[model samples]
Target: MWYYVIPALVIFGVVHVYTKSWLYILLRTWRRDLKALIRFSKVNYYLLKWERRNMTVPKVFVDVAAKHPHKVAFYFEDDIWSFQRVDEYSNRVANFFLSEGYQQGDCVALLLESRPEYVCLWLGLSKIGVKAALINTNLTGDSLVHSIEVASSKALIFGSDFERTLKDIQSKIVHLNKYQFNENMSLSKTLFDNAKDLRVCLKESPIDAVTEHIQKGNLKDHILYIYTSGTTGLPKAAVITNVRYMVMAVGLNKMVNVQDNDCIYDSLPLYHTAGGILGTGQALLCGATIAIRKKFSASNFWKDCVRYRCTIAQYIGETCRYLLATDDNNLVKHSVRAMFGNGLKAQIWKPFAEKFGIKEIYEFYGATESNSNLVNIDSTVGAVGFVPFYAKFLYPVSLVQCDEVTGEPLRDSNGRYTICRQNEPGVLIGKISALRAVNQFTGYADKVATEKKILRNVFSEGDMYFNTGDILMYDDFGYFYFKDRTGDTFRWKGENVSTSEIEAVISDIANLSDAVVYGVEVPGAEGKAGMAAIVDQTRSLDLEQFAEGLRKHLPVYAQPIFIRLVDSVELTGTFKLIKRDLVVEGFNIHVVKDEIFFYDVRTKRFVPLTKELYDLIMQGKVRL
Candidate 1:
């Protein structure tokens, strides 16, 4: 009987491995996807919970604290703060603000790096019904002044690291009360001391006052004034309501199925949406611990992850690229199961996932102020987000044909905007209205800037939509792929060329660490000529091979005409490429100290842009 039982078990195992039985396959998939379905259900539950009760983020934090008081909310460096501890810290911060004559509805500028104190202050300000303008700590001079002034911030709570930056622009800011985060040897020493003293004196603020603010506050009421990265120009103050924060917090956590024991590595700055709200908020929403870092360090990325036993990590494309570029073994070391963020390039997505041993890449698409959000739940490489067939009717996201020259949406004879056909690149827009709960674009602090984003009388009379300013295309499978920004696409040789496409080709060809692709005006060229600023760390680029590869991958018009090799690529604090200076410099060898190369159409190879060739090109003697 024992011999017969062993033989039967062996036969069953063999058949299970080799055969594709319908019942077996069905059970396998159900078992695999059961957890994901439960996570989705949790997301719906949270959304419904928030809708039923008009709960603010601070109120939610308090509720969570009451439920799990001893749960570690945040882990910074070597220190850990529980939910109750953070709540108490925030209460002190609220009392400190109140003690300094601050009141409800007043704006407070927060110029700080990533730290536990930053979170405390943010929650504290929210508790007191104060709008916190999370100013980029990297900003200084006119840019810094404009950001604070735009939010009408009366007081500034900055990290000690930014004392030098604050001192530089001290005279420019008006009606500003400054309080340094830690070590106040410079400005606001008194405020710093008072805040600390108040923390001990007043362990908690009046909860009823906070409750009243929450009761009066609707989803539209501004709680956060987060400024856009403003890579192209001055940063614009974007209003973020308590409801939006809640949505970001709960939506991201549930989508990722973050567990209470899960630890997330967050090295992104607290001023930006990805780090400050979306990333940090997820930790607060779930009873999870976030290992907060001062800034992203490629060398320290995995070391911190392994040390903290992080199961999740956040990223921007540049950060991922930076980590990949490093020679450190830290890239492969760690327990990171998932990564969530936007700006992940199509080419880098799979390699990053494979190399890092990441199980899930939850790429989402949405701008700072835009209401349209698409999350790629399925690991569709290069696709930022997907709208499943079942949910297509529910979501109002659309892509409209855009004019090549003006970069605006094209309308038909009946004044209806034309929708892009399948796989056709077009500007993405989301329908916005008071009636729609999800697709609401509250716009920026500047009314003019906000008004510029709205398209009226599109598709039908009186119809309105929020222009995402992003050119994207959707496949037959309903997976959306970002092509390029409307402003980034340029026309050349009677054909429109996407800089992102060119960059992708360049990345495949040269394996560049960093590349900034942009169109520059050639002296006599009819359209903007393509140029790429590249940082080749190896300093051993094969010019002929690169030229041949570009010719093979891209059309003649789309190929970059000029390439400038730089020591380092300039990027904004948020890791966005800084192209203004590059555009101004163009390919002038004298202006840009970097070695510049021009594509020789006749030779079908790249040659150094000598003075003779430069003059010939500028004088229209040479055809591009």
Candidate 2:
């Protein structure tokens, strides 16, 4: 009896230790991968069925509407749009477009604000196999004209709200037919000579389903073209196929456990992939209700969530940081249990969730066109996603060693790309296969642009993979963490420095409202020198305390050599930092209006950057 009892105790001790180890986390992640695959199999079955029937999103939406006709599909400000109403409205749009002689494969440019009609119009156009180019509403002048011309749009459909914007670019876009729809139900004629009133046409059009005239297309057909942010350069139109839309919608819905009863509060612009596809897809594909906001209001975010009784919320870029900076007195107990998006920083994750009473955070990582998508299902603190060692074959995603400067994959003597070891930073790539929807890369509308993203002969003779252009690392637990973008991570003092990591630290130390970090060229520096632009609206930032904090929290090499203080930071529509202009102006006092400072090695403090110092730095007289 003594011998048997001793053996049992020893076994119990071993089991407890195993459960506490990283191996246990890896095992749980494997279980999660298996369960996710099992759930995704259902999506594949429907995709196959839809492909065989040659059905697109509109057809699938019709089936969903039949089951839940009276369900509230969208909540926009003071109005509620029911499934039946949206379905009928979309049918009217389809009929109206058909009457205009718009055939399958024709392209139309859509420039509209965030509203239910945006989704309805796109869905309606998709019915006739006409792909809608969803242009960024914030674009103006040359950028706006280039977006339309790049897509080769035959027609431009815009809301009356953008009439002024259209009038400015009317000369450039005069070749294309234009249609303007009134948001308010008033019968109004278009201001442009070539533009027509789409609202009036829609009112007279039949509301009956245009099933007979629906285009004969499969899941692989292009339905929409969502543009990139254009932060670094001009926006590129990424092709969104029916299958890609469904995959994005279903994959996120199933993994995050979003239900039909959930109401998602989306304040993001409607033209983006996060807002247009993922947010609206919940309502169209999963039968959930979406609450739309024209623009993000950090002060009113929580109030709106409570008002809508939303079960889920969406955010992107620095949205979470802005919310955290807002006054807490306005926040109230609400029904939002989950918050999902891509760019929540690790420093504010736990605090934001706890303060807002959020139960789960589905932090995800993916580009508008890349097939390399990831989501943190279990709410791991800093993890974007997880892929266990044993589950690599199933996921088809790997981290490959690459040149930090150029982001090109490094090949071994075998002429094959080498996989990064655990805890090593590498660029993430997803194997592309035409056979599976999950692994397919639909790519951009430009053939040359699309080809540039595909890395051929990755591991074998003819294997192809989509380069994600993001640097990431996985720990021993198989939890992946986002390091930085390929071009954003610069080397300094023989050490690779991540701009995002430094930005997070600066934001925390200085109590800054916003911060943008980048690398700038110094005359004598071997690599790019670090520079940080911080927003101090009230001019309350204590430089001494900030310097002390940085010294304590960050390594000596990772510290920013130059600092620029601005009243505010310029951001893209999605709240992403616009660094192109800032980077170009880089520590040049003559070009930059903002106050600049530099770290003095002897003084061990930040000192005002005078013209003499700037000249010295440029002449290589001052050591960086």
Candidate 3:
């Protein structure tokens, strides 16, 4: 006993002496790491209880409703719905679907705006094991028909707001049933033969049949079809399972630290995953309220937050810019303390927070179909995801070296992927192994597109991984930052330029609401030349100022050689910048409707693209 005590005392004295020097720093770091680990475990432990039970989104909502019956579940412009009320409404919707001959595994197309009824209708369909194809309400014509056809929907349920678009494509849509929400009985009876008011649909009493049907379904079953933003091409129908929705609900609630009395301010469209699952579904899961807007109004954004008493909000990359563009002084007075979503630009993160008094911004990186998902819980500016060193072994997310041109993972001599070194940009990939349930990539309904996302024989035989098309880089601390989309990165002057990075810079310019950066082929030039299509709201396109800002921020090669100023730029329903049309239109003054300008190297200012300059550029005479 004496020997043991003496040795312990000696060791303690030595440790105390070490604490006086820099050696004490290691212990502090260890303590901080331990705290983070405990916090992560606590959050996951609560979520795991439901994940183990295989609880679906509808089931979770029901549970919350049972717990907080009188609590406000949803808030629209002038309407408020209690949790119990919405739960009963969804039950009526389930009964209505069954009465109309809907069955398990049936597909229904939903074209509606963000409303309390819209959410209840979808949740009701989910109760009866029906997958709702969330079509973009902005879509019409052939695109709308194609989305419905691709989804193989048996029914089309639309809102009265989109009655005109529905009527235009009414004949083209080959669905077994067409139903429209008879809001105020304004929708024409001739347009849609089967029209039912939302109130009339909610007349049926809540029944046990819905709960029993939901209990019969498994976690792996498809719950919804979320379409990708067709910015690069036509949208693909991504299959979302019950388990995935559960993950979104629980995962977001935990990450954002949602409170029971909190109200979420969500202006994003419901058709997208961010607005649908992460926004509304999260609020339902956590027994929190939601303030949904019909459409995103930049001017009314702050006023709505204060009006609804919203403590949380959802946003995309473009959301902050629009809010910042407004001059409304109401931005400072609000209950919004935190926000959760992806696509928040690094340049706007600090300003957006300081201006609006946001305490936390849970920026994230994920797609509708990809299994690779990560969230930045620590509010690190510019970081899309975080991978703590202690959890790195458990997390399968990784960056792999890929071909710059083909955007494919590079194979080694044994046909194995080479992991990207720290601080090097590479395409992010996540392992999909039977050993890990969280890594399952349930992909799209189209088998070909599903297979296209999978990479085989990576790292080991029979190994598979999900390829994320975007490039990312992680620091030694495991903070991941987005570089650019694989296809969006273009080579110019023998160097690669990230379109997203450039767009972020341009988006930071005052009065420039939005920008789309792309590469266009230049005659005799080594590779594609950088071009920008910008939305100038102020109509004060000072060429000297714009060029000066570009020079200060970007390198000569990375700066746009041509600038096209448009009154409005096209965007996907999810608020992502669409560059396909801009890329196709290029800087051709003859074909383009907007004003085009070319960078004058000699004067270091942009000059209007005239016939002589266009000819000079086409003939390789211009230095640009």
Candidate 4:
């Protein structure tokens, strides 16, 4: 028997080495060498650099404004605006800034929602080398002020709809104007009295002469100053150059297969990177039409897709999932064949394709500050994509050096920057310098706070890397997956706990819209206890069934000890889950309005959250 087992083991090893088969063969094609297989491979869509001839974004609008002047550039409800109209309005708004003494290096802030006016102001500032710093209007007080100062915007253009939020921070701006549209609903002579009539202003001799003399901006200069959708800490303003936008356009058009006849349904916020910097920029650059909505609506999504003949759509996490959760039969009838953007988790990736008949999804990884990007050209599940060769695109991943008691890198005799082994989750970083620019973090209120994020001597002496502060793991083949955030991940009973990994398991439960997993500090305990906050509270929880589900999927330390029921999870402007308030409100019995309960691993059931149980858990008297 021993002699036969030895021969069988050798045969198994040979078989495993020869076969690297996949359920989806095309998804693995990205691993092929671009230099050798690019020409023959259908999956290899783009080269490292797009074009030597610098293509600026304003050139896109200017070309369309000339070629398709009379054709509709945008549509809403029954209203239509032609490329000529967009150019005309944007021109006057441009003149408005110039006449007010705004110049080449000045900062202009955009605090409006998605509208034709947003584009008007965007192009307006681009005309004179003035950069537009788009700020999220949902943010308030200190957050609002922080964004304004970060961009150093001397002038602000705001939508009158948010008169109060604008008014709250009015005293801070250098110069401010509340822009109101004189649309069909309010076209009265009285309504036109106060607001500037852009059409009337353009017809005047002064603005018309200026249109004849259009100034071009340097392709290398920064045109956009946008920020990270700060969920954990203060957001960082990112400087986006014309060259990067041009690179994005080439990459996006190829990845999503955008064409002249296609219409894209976009409701994602323009202030963020996806909508304005990537989506709208690419649409205009590709000569494709866009049907811009005020905001994302789960109920209205399918209907909008159908009504607009939208061939392509952009989505983020929870957006696609919520639309799928609606169980709408009309999903199949819509024209959304290709979906692009990021964060399509593994659970819904397959079902979304099957249920909606989606032919393609370009799930690529890009940030406002990242020089590297990976596009899912071959429909790879759970991959961020590939970075160009110049930077080697090696995501600086973190490796736990030793036990939690020590804070140092575990080193080999080689004395190199020790990182996680392949497929092992760790903190992710990107090399930042004059090249492979990662200029997103612009220091917090304190300059010292800003310097803390910069990691030096990364792989070699004197080399610097920008800390991503995100936990990620990479495969042998260059594909990357997000594990969790550094602060969000915790140590639990001698094991490192990935909060996102645990949430991914628990989120499968019925009626859970979203779930956030974190750790709670317990006295006398060596590590923290895991906790979960599920969004839906209307349906009573079946402890027996849930515990069985979790036990089957997650490891012992990964299983949540406490279950919190929330009506809805509070989110940042970017739709990222907010955990700060939850952590601050911590499971205080008297303060919490929502029902709190604990899972007893010993009993394998959930018990009522009592004062006695809470006290015992806090003192580490109760064993998890």
How far out, in Å, is residue 372 in model 3? 1.5
Q: Residue 282, candidate 4: how far off, in angstroms?
A: 1.6
Give candidate 3 misplaced runs (Cα > 4 Å).
1-36, 185-190, 194-209, 229-233, 328-330, 434-437, 488-624
In the range 300-399, model 2's lDDT, one tens digit per residue, is: 8988998889999998746787788678777778899998998776878899888888899999988889899988888899889887666777779999
Worst 10 residues of 2 by lDDT: 227-236
Position 446, candidate 3: lDDT: 76
Clashes of 3: 1
lDDT tens digits by residue: candidate 3, 1-624: 787998898887688666543344334345535544665565567556766897777777788898979988889988889988888888888988888889999999898878888888888898998989998765555557767988889988877777777666667764448776755554445356555555555565455447788787777778899976322334578999887776666666766677777889989888888888888886677777889998888888888998998888988766676677668554458888899887677877898898888898999888877778888877889998777555667668889998765466899988899999779989999988643445778888778768877998988999888988878999766789988666656756424466766787787753577888888877655457899988886668777888887875565667899998888877656233356667677888889978899999999888999989999999977887
lDDT of 1 by residue, 1-624 (tens): 788999898888678656744444445445334554566567667766776786778777777888889888888888898888888787777766877788778999987778887888878887778889988665555557888998888887766666566666666764577665553333434323323322333444543335554456555568888876321335678878876776677777887677888888999888878888877886666667888998788888989999889999998776887677678444556789999987777777887787888899988888768777777776778888765434545568899999753357988888889988779999899988765445667777888878888999987889789988878898755678987666656655434466765666678789877788888877645557899988876669999999877765555667889999987876656233367578779988678888899998888988999989898988878868
List lDDT for all candidates, in order: 0.75, 0.82, 0.77, 0.64
Clash pairs, model 1 backbone: none
Report how far off residue 339 is in candidate 1 (Å). Answer: 0.8
Better of 2 and 4 by TM-score: 2
* lDDT score of residue 610 within candidate 3: 97
After superposition, candidate 4 runs with Cα above 4 Å error: 1-55, 67-72, 171-216, 229-233, 330-332, 386-416, 433-453, 488-624
- TM-score, per-candidate, Cα-based: 0.72, 0.78, 0.75, 0.68
- Sort all candidates by TM-score, best to worst: 2, 3, 1, 4
Best by TM-score: 2
- Cα deviation of 71, candidate 1, in Å: 0.9
